[model samples]
Target: MKDSDSPRRRWWHVDPGGALGGLLLAVLSATPSLLPRAALFQGLITAVAFAVGYGVGTAAWLGIRRLVPMRSRPILWIAYGVLWLVAVGALSVLAVAWQNEVRRAVEMPPLDAVDLAGFLLGFLPVVVILIAVGKLNRRVFRALQRMSGTPVALLGTLTALIAGIAATVLVVMFGVDAVYKGLNGAPDAEAVEPSSEFRSAGAGSAIRWEDLGRHGSAFIGGGPTASEITALTGVEAKDPIRVYAGLESAETPEARAQLVVDELERTGAFDRSVLVVATTTGSGWLEAQTVDAIEYLHAGDTAIAAMQYAYTPSWVSFLFDPDAPVESARALFDAVEERWSRLPADDRPELIVYGLSLGAHGGQAVFDGLGDLRSRADGAMFVGSPNGSALWRTLQGARDPGSPVWQPVLADGREVRWISRAGDESLLPGPWSEPRVLYLQHATDPVTWLTPELIWSPPEWLDPSQRADDVSPEMRWIPVVTAVQVGIDMLGGEAVPARHGHNFGDVVTTGWREVAGDAGLDQAAVDRIQEEIEGYAPIQPYLE
Candidate 1:
């Protein structure tokens, strides 16, 4: 044995006990997963296996020390570093892959910045365990050397139990909140069939109150089904269709668009489809999508349970680089066009484009980006549009400033109906002469008045115009809170955003019948909607 003052003993020595402790810490960090039967089990098992392998590796290090008898320690440290890198890196990559696969299989919405926060924090236990175990192992080893017959086995067992309990407690306490929030964050159901068993479901006239609740608890909200939105639009089998929706604060166009796709599938009316791209500013419109879906909510299920997927490439961040969104929107449109392009080429599908707020601005961007592609589509509609008077701004750069070829008039000379809502002056008049545009105004919405955050933009064309000015900062808080209270009163487990909006959507949908009939759109299919809309009499101003 070397002298007590030797450099190896004092500073440069390797501690096998410390290595064992580090390995134990890794295994302990991964062990609790066995109880949950999570999809992460394979990755966790692999990590534990790596830890055991690392502990066994210490024997190789000892053998090297005895055989080579080298004074320099560089090789040993390098080997250890390489081992750690390979083992830890493999585990990390596997964990991410496993997580992504499982999440995708269920069509879980993309995790927002807030959702990942707990996963980010889960690293703390490993650091703490490594520190505690290192010190404890060193002290225990020193004691063994000083004593005659110290029970090393007992010491190792105690260390493992301590590490295991610490890791379990920390992971459980910190991880549970995040996991629950993540699972609950997405809208609940993919669809709801109200007529089946939910014939009598809804809150009583009395106002109840509560806040957040667990998944099945009588207090949460969800997204709506495609059927509900279609029912609300009241688009008869024959009339042209217009779709209006928004991107959630935490949802993307891709995710929300999935719901739209499902709606189209159910309607079987997408022989021609128009896309109204939006910039990110008016993402609040996604709430309208939720409302559309909610109209079909049932008593026992949450609203969002009916939603199939969330939209993606959310407009909020897409607004950062206006050009970037233009490119992406163009690509999306092109892909959609291509999907429909080959079907009966001679009889081309009539296509149009329009959007309002962020979508309107973004739609303009898409037009500018596409150049010739705009001509491919037939007509467009914009509400609360952002394009200026210039042709480039208005027509997505499709029409030239002085093009006589594009007539802006109808045969009978009524306006072409380029309806502008919410008083957006930036959406100037078309240079095209004589009735090429129509303006739809809501007196309450301040965005048209350029009021900053003072009013809520109407959630949908169907929402009561009176509610547009509901600018309470707490509007965001009310839905979640109201859902809980309303859900309990209704005897439902939890109310989703989609479910809560059901009444709103139902009122809007059923009311459309009157709107169509008054407009002389009365047909057999549209009678139900017209009667509902006419009955309310309250939503008239908003509809008009």
Candidate 2:
């Protein structure tokens, strides 16, 4: 009915401020979701559902207040307001304490400034909304009383409100999914290249030197070749060797591993270069940028060898057959280690390992445990490791009791360094010494932190002791709500800047300096290297 025809003013007319406050929250909560990879949408959806639920619950509470006798209406309102503050404050404090302890023990990012008062400040908006909603709810009962005499008017108003809510929900859900689809299939120039001669090889087939870098284009392969590397850095690139034995080349891992080693020997990799054995994701795609970082640090005296185990993209491979990484990783590493050992000890060059994302999961398969990893390779760097990866879990578990997961300063940063950002020296109890293990992770990367346990358990990151500043300080765990939210978090996990997500851009240069300190590359040299490596990314190939 039109306002003129209505018997009384609308429900929102009773408390305009309350309606405005709720509307503002709804907008804020949903706005970030419009961005490419904003994980905050998970919280936005939950807040909307919460508002709907609370609106219903508050209406019922207001109804009870009308039927029951109270000493004073003012006193009852004051009591409820006090209780809400107390409850919110208590929960925030307890959670912060737990989070602080864990972050300290693990050497994760520290949020010491997040005390009780600041914590409460974060929830100030929620408190305001609570007061507003309660007032609106009280007015709802009064509005009901005004409509009781007119049954036709009451039914029409109820129907309109329900329909409005449903329409809003549908719009939000459909809009989010549509945006996700568009981003997922966006085209890129590098992804258009076709494969070269690395597809199939016989038992004793020779390597195709000409077919390297997607048939000499240098724009279609994993890493820069010798000439490209030298040109970019002005350093005498020592053949910038890279060899990959495709899965189609041989029937078994043993054959593939041998093929990889054969190519390595052909390039004289075992003679004088530092050998880096990297494993690719399911798409058989390697991190050519990582290769560029190493070559710049080592002055092009490094050889990188890897083998294709699957032909699909990393995500598809991770979902369908996660174990493919484990199998191929173990096979390739075992084969390379066995052959590298055959060379004379004095002449044997240093061997390092690199694995990022799914490849990191597989590359970890070569070691039985941390002990084995320490004994086997000179150094190793695993970036954006998934929550399911065993090696990541082990070191994280071993960290001190109070450290956070995102940037744990494990065991005084002795043998291992878990880095989320630059300038992590404070996490180190002393100097950057020994075994030289570098783990690059970002607090915003859901792929690294999301797990089944998030539903049943409060994710360690939410403790407020050390989550990234980008994340909401008041984010709370609400069973299935948070699980669904984090599930969405995966979609835009890499949507962050190099310092924040799976996209670890220039930081790799810094990481290499720490892991390969023997290179004697100073800060200026590292900066120069970072710039050179970034230059190749524009034309770098994108694999399936």
Candidates in order, TM-scores: namely 0.30, 0.62
Best by the lDDT measure? 2
lDDT of 2 at 201: 27
Give the alpha carbon lDDT tens digit for every residue of 1-544 in model 1. 5574463454444354345444544443332110111223333333443344444555465565576545556776777678766766665554454444423322234333443344434444443444445445656656655653556865765687689889998787556435534543333354221221111111221111111112211111223334542354443222222222222211444444443334333333344322222222221222233122113211111111111111222222232334434443454455445544655765534444434333444455554333353354444333333323223233323333332211112222232322222223223344433212222222212222222111333222212332322122112212222222222212111111111211122222222111111223334433444343334322211100
* Candidate 2: 10-residue stretch with minimal lDDT: 30-39
Evaluate residue 65 in candidate 1 and report its C-alpha lDDT on the 0 to 100 scale: 57
Tell me model 2's lDDT, rounded to 2 decimals: 0.62
Question: Compared to the true structure, candidate 1 yields what TM-score?
Answer: 0.30
Best by TM-score: 2
Off by over 4 Å in 1: 1-185, 188-328, 345-349, 369-374, 387-416, 420-445, 448-544
**lDDT of candidate 2 over 372-454, digit per residue (tens):** 99888888989878888888898888887777877787767778888777676455768656568888887766668778898
lDDT of each: 0.33, 0.62
